[model samples]
Target: MNIEWFLVLSALLFTVGLIGVIVRRNPVVILLCLELMLSAGALALLAFSRMLGNQDGQVFVLIVLVVAACEVVVGLGLVVAMYRRRLPLDVDEMKELKG
Candidate 1:
């Protein structure tokens, strides 16, 4: 629909994701929040691109998607590796690196 609507929706989702990132103690939830933030960013980019009838926004959105994908892969890999080695996924419980 309208660019404003898209932007507002994206802002709301991004805010929610930010809150999740800050309040959640689970690594998986943090990663999910990161994904949500990325999706909101992509949506905003696409909406602007459509409003302006330009390809730059689309290109940016594509790049953002690719980066998000890579982030998800790496983040999940790290989480799994940590779980295997640390025996737990709680952020507060991670004290191995505090030494």
Candidate 2:
């Protein structure tokens, strides 16, 4: 029931997500990690908002959720496109996407 507990959980989620993003090779897994990171941030924001007894952070968290949803849509679209093109799903081999 403490703000510190929420913050600690958020930090742990963020750390796990960071590690996943760094260690995973698959694009899908990377995207999932990125979502995890976003969720962690949103969780922290909600915690702070609750602690402060304000609506601002909740509004921002809503915006963040919208952005995260957009990111997932675009990311999955790209992944599907790549799969349709018979491209490798591995992030390392995605260097060809560089312009």
Candidate 3:
């Protein structure tokens, strides 16, 4: 029931997501990690909003969700396109997009 508990949970989620993003090489996995991070952020925002008793945090979370959705759509589209082209899915080897 305390805000600290929610904050701790959010921190844990964010840490896990950060580790996943750093340790994984697959593009899909990276995207998933990104989503996890975003969710963590949203959770923290909602928790704070609840603590403060306001609608602003809820509205921001909604916006974050929409942005996350758009990011997933574009990210997955790129991954699919890369797959179709028979390109390597490893993030380390993705040098063609450097331009």
lDDT string, candidate 1, 3-65, tens digits: 899999999999999999999999899999999999998998899889989999999988999
Residue pairs in collision within model 3 = none
Query: Cα deviation of 23 in candidate 2 (Å)?
Result: 0.2
Clashing pairs in 1: none
Question: Can you tell me which runs of candidate 2 are displaced by over 4 Å?
Answer: none
Candidate 2 accuracy as TM-score = 0.97
lDDT, candidates in the order shown: 0.91, 0.96, 0.96
For model 1, the superposed segments whose C-alpha errors exceed 4 Å read: none
lDDT of 2 at 97: 91
**Local accuracy of candidate 2 as per-residue lDDT tens digits, 12-61:** 99999999999999989999999999999999999999999999999999
The order of the candidates by TM-score, greatest first, is 3, 2, 1
Residue pairs with backbone overlap in model 2:
none
Give RMSD to native, each candidate. 1.5, 0.6, 0.6
RMSD of 3: 0.6
> Runs in model 3 with CA error above 4 Å?
none
